[model samples]
Target: MKTLLSLSIGALLAGSSLLSTSALAATHAPYTHTQFSITESVQPADILVVLVPENAGELRLAGWDRASRNHINRAIEVAGFDGKAGAQLEIVAPVGLSYGRLLLLGTGNPADLTRAKAETMGASLSTWVNGTKAESIHVNSQLIANAADNHRISAALAHGVELRNYRFDRYKSQPEARPSQRYSWQVALATDARSKFEQKQALAQGVFTARELTNLPGSDGYPEAFANYAKTVLEPLGVEVTILGPEEVKALGMGALYGVSQGSHMKAHLLVARWRGHDDAQPIALVGKGNSFDTGGYNLKTQAASILRMHTDKAGGAAVVGAVKALAGQKAPVHVVGVVPLSINMISGDAYLPGDVVTAGDGTTIEVGNTDAEGRLILADGIWYAREHLNARVIADIATLTGAKVGALGSAYSAIFTQDAAIEQSLRQAGELVQERVWPMPLDGYDGIVRSRIADKINTGSPGAQAGAIFLQHFAADTPWVHIDMAGEAFVSSASGIHPEGSTGHGVRLLTEWAKLYQAKQD
Candidate 1:
């Protein structure tokens, strides 16, 4: 039997308050990313953000009046700020504008603009505003709104600001001062799109939630603690959260997953959060690898540089937890199930070692080729549990599984593996929409790599790095599954547009968008 993890509800609740869980509130708070406002005219603000496109030596402000356009043109000429994609120039208290400063932002060419660029620009704006004393921003999206249809530019821009503005200040005695909360955003020509803005804002809430959970110290939660945090945030959204302790997992014959947590005193768990908005539809399962902290077991990561940051090993589970919360919050008409297998790989007398054999819940025995390759071991059980117990028709698993993945893809894109063409296309669309890029990779002659001498299969291939997606397929049986190896994408050491410097909260938006598209097609 697997060692079971238990939740301390009272303690978890205490931590929940610290999480600042909801982004639904209109008024900004430390946890709340930012607030949205729609306006027909530019409001008097500390900063006026204008989106301008490149035009050689000539500056064209076609969207504004003659005087306003001429003033901006002359300023652009004098400042020498070409409307390049990321170019920015601040005009402090320009004569024609009511605001104290006119922030001229570049957008390449107006016709060539897209949602991704707009969002990145928005994030860039937020980062700049944070560094300045400016507390309010009035965005003039007049020129770029038509660049991307479906209000995509404005909606995505707001989404990016909401994302970039997330701050985890609960633990800070003197939290760094941020202008996001005290800040006000006025988007010109968006009065009619209040509902759309709110919807995008709601999605941002999910991304922020995932970031919070991932940013939390690994010491804050092992398997049990992670589940407790999920329940605390998800229960109020009316999402049905079921916690399966190690015993329950063992009962289902998830020996492969169970064996990983054998050495740790903190019990491992599988947390399932469900949102059954449509009764007739077959549920789509989102499985995550929630390795609370990995110590590499017997195959110690003694030479690892960032071993201390292993706390973020649960980015996948956090994404799953955040996805259901946002879906339920948005009231999307899709039946969804999220399965997060939570555990911590520790060093102890009882720790599972390399060469040990573990029988998975699906009855496939996995030879422990490397104890450090613990993610797929846990995912083996999560993937099976989602398929069988949850009756999930489609399964998508996300994990920070392999170091080789980081070496291969870097932070540019998460590696996606699947033989199914449709799954790849769906995820690709979702990733593009959110700026979280996914690269499709072939599962070449990899089956032979994991062939074992003793067990039915080994946990990993010979080189042992790029085998995550391939090894996971063995436990998936006949189920059509998509594995996202986000080793490089999940945690970022440097800040980028709309994304802070840590725990990227990578899969929440992609997973959410995929479910939305699936539901739309079904309808």
Candidate 2:
């Protein structure tokens, strides 16, 4: 085993800022600044959104006054919109109505209106009202029975709107204005909803940060730049940011991570961020693969999609940073550490070939099966570092590891591999809660597949996703761990609901939810 050389954040930041402060300011600022508030009475707005449940017998709009409800009921009857979840109806308010427009948002079966569904409803509503050019809007939370339910549902709704309003136009020299940018929100409820929504807002901002990082071009979003950005954003939020350069990584014997960066001039970076919410508790480690751009190394990606969209290869690491940001911003009472192995996989004379054998930080040798299978190799070192050096009791490593995962689960869900049933269940529940749903993939019966004749294991094997998981499992050793393959979930080809056409920032909310749950258990 190699000696772990601890370094201060100041030392790391001095040499690693590839972008200037002005450049960072232009590129890294928050994209949306929509204001939100909760009030006792419905405020005047261009539009009024009433949450409506399906009629068991009569049309129901519980919160609105009798005159407004009667007008909306007539509009609903004319539109023939059944009060199914996600069903929406908008009508021009008549002469007597106070608002310019009225929107009836369905809750489906009242019992079926979960937090997840409520978020989706908010996304759908935001998307629908985009072109309507509404400057201010009020969402009636009156139908929700009690203050607690109203707070939770309103927070969820506003979170969805915040997420849906995300726009990545940094690169656009003359971007068109989005109406969501100008709107202010009022969610009508009895009790204060800002605190709950503030927590969710932190998460939304985290997701936005992740999306911006993922969407940045490889030319601008290199390893050093990522480290610099993390230090700038996370450190202020009380995260301890430590960055290790190539020589330092080599000294630490992170050969598997270092090997991938051999071809690139940018070198490699191991970014460790600690959010110490507790004094002495063992932290949950989030290890992510941070390949800023992937060119399949010496193997070379001949396909256009693989080469063109390779900038998003670092999304897993971006998500880890985002989750940390969210946890720190919300002041969650949980100790968590994010370990990201940053590199750019390019084809060059110095590139590590497919047949090369690299030693991991734990001294396990990994025979590179394919240069394109570089994510697992880097994560191997990251997971080991987290488990051994950071004293993380539970390790969850996420990456855009395989195309086979997309083939298996499509873009709808992330693929999770874990031996622990509890970890799997918790991750699934968290993912579901945040709309970043995960489907469990088998981790067993693949021990032989990753077995190599010379090394401890091969980087990849026959069943791509399973074999990759097995190889990473060796690094985690006996520690409880879960591997999330988010290849298909990270980038979207088209805009849908809350997601735009670029990076989805998928894992931020899921990881935050899981970490919160894990913290509760620890407490």
Candidate 3:
């Protein structure tokens, strides 16, 4: 970790020269004096200055005071361009002196101060300073206050920017450098003196940890390696970790998981992580499908679809582990048992055929209608084991389980299916708060699609490709469970806001926030 940190520092300093005071002042100073024809009194020293269009002149007056025409001063300098839209200025006077730089960011219209807009502006600012060497940043809360709840909005904006600014250049030979030296950052709040920034910080740490896990390649993040990583990350937080190897899984009668692992040379394992934050409480169980690589078994996927990006099928398990890490890191007052059913689904002579019949840990036999429908197969035993053996009160399983969900929801939101509406609503609300959307779909009538003619259930849908989410819900068996199919949103092909292209690290923030809320309600 120290070496990585050192490399990061070295990368930042390599391309740029030692920053000079005058040059630094020119680049880092906040106030830009560019001319603008406005009726309001604008001062460079003010943390937040109001900008109202000439049209809506009949607003409020207390937080708004305009100087006469004769009271106007020189030209207004803008932050970015010298002659573009308007002026960019930095407030470098009394209030901004300690902060070193104060930037007057431009909004084309004064009415654009809505919360979403403010967050966008914050994100833009963070992007502009990506490689720069600025330590702590303070933005005037007034600009975003009218747009959003000041503290919450600002914290989220700060979080988005900080997370976006993270770069994984550990292996780069000669990395480019940026100015700004504070490794740690502080976002000055414009509102609410009692905001929960500490909690938010912990949540941010958890998200970062998840990002790290998801970013690792399949070779480094296989079942055994992933389990070891989880142990190393969570055990120090006082979370009890248990890794069940192939022998233990077989002995425990996790036939569904074992059947899925029959094709791969690598052994299947189940990781049970328990964080007893409070004593004598029924744990909330999180089950994740850990298919490290999926080759579709006997029902093989195309070479284009199965070769390079197959590793990301384990992202669901990554999220579960990530959420646990976050929960333990924050020391939340709720017990959580995370069950990750880990394996590689490959095709071989010894691989289970499409017509094979396998029994789950609960003694329910399932006919393998399609070997490609393997995620649900593994998760079946995992969810059952978590509920029956661990005695879970609430169970939620996440997986890149189906392509149909991607077709239904696109890349914008993950599809959620649950028997309990309350849990579904909570998860949806949490996802909204974090800007990771989740849409709930029906799970009640979907059992009919998975009903088997010969066995208790079937692993897949009928001949056609309809209702993939519904078919996967059969594995949850009657438990109060929520199934999150993050197939589309788990990994991206390009960068968007805080999410990079490789691994979106989708559910970490949402699950962590939901856990916090659940714990609060329990308390």
Superposed on all Cα atoms, the candidates' RMSDs to the truth, in angstroms, are 7.6, 7.2, 10.2
lDDT tens digits, residues 171-242, model 1?
678877654433333343344455566667657767777887788776675788778778877777789999
444 Cα displacement, candidate 3 (Å): 3.7
RMSD of candidate 3 to the truth, in angstroms, is 10.2
- What are the Cα lDDT values of the candidates? 0.76, 0.80, 0.63
Structural similarity to truth (TM-score) of each candidate:
0.87, 0.91, 0.75
Residue range with the least summed lDDT across 10 consecutive positions in model 2: 6-15
Model 1 TM-score (2 dp): 0.87
RMSD of 2: 7.2
TM-score of 2: 0.91
* Per-residue alpha-carbon lDDT of candidate 3 for residues 1-523, written as tens digits (9 for 90 to 100): 1111110211111111113311111111111111111111222331332222223223232322343111111223122223121224444332313334445455434433343344455455666554334443434434333433444544544555545544444335685442232322121231232234344445555565555556655555567766776776677778899999988998988888998888766778999999887774688888888888887888888779545777788888888887887777667877888899998887787788988998888888989998888898888888888888898878888888888787778878888877787788889878877777888876554447777888987877742233455554555566677888888677767766776456767788878878767666667
Model 3 Cα shift for residue 155 (angstroms): 3.2
lDDT ranking of the models: 2, 1, 3
Best model per TM-score: 2
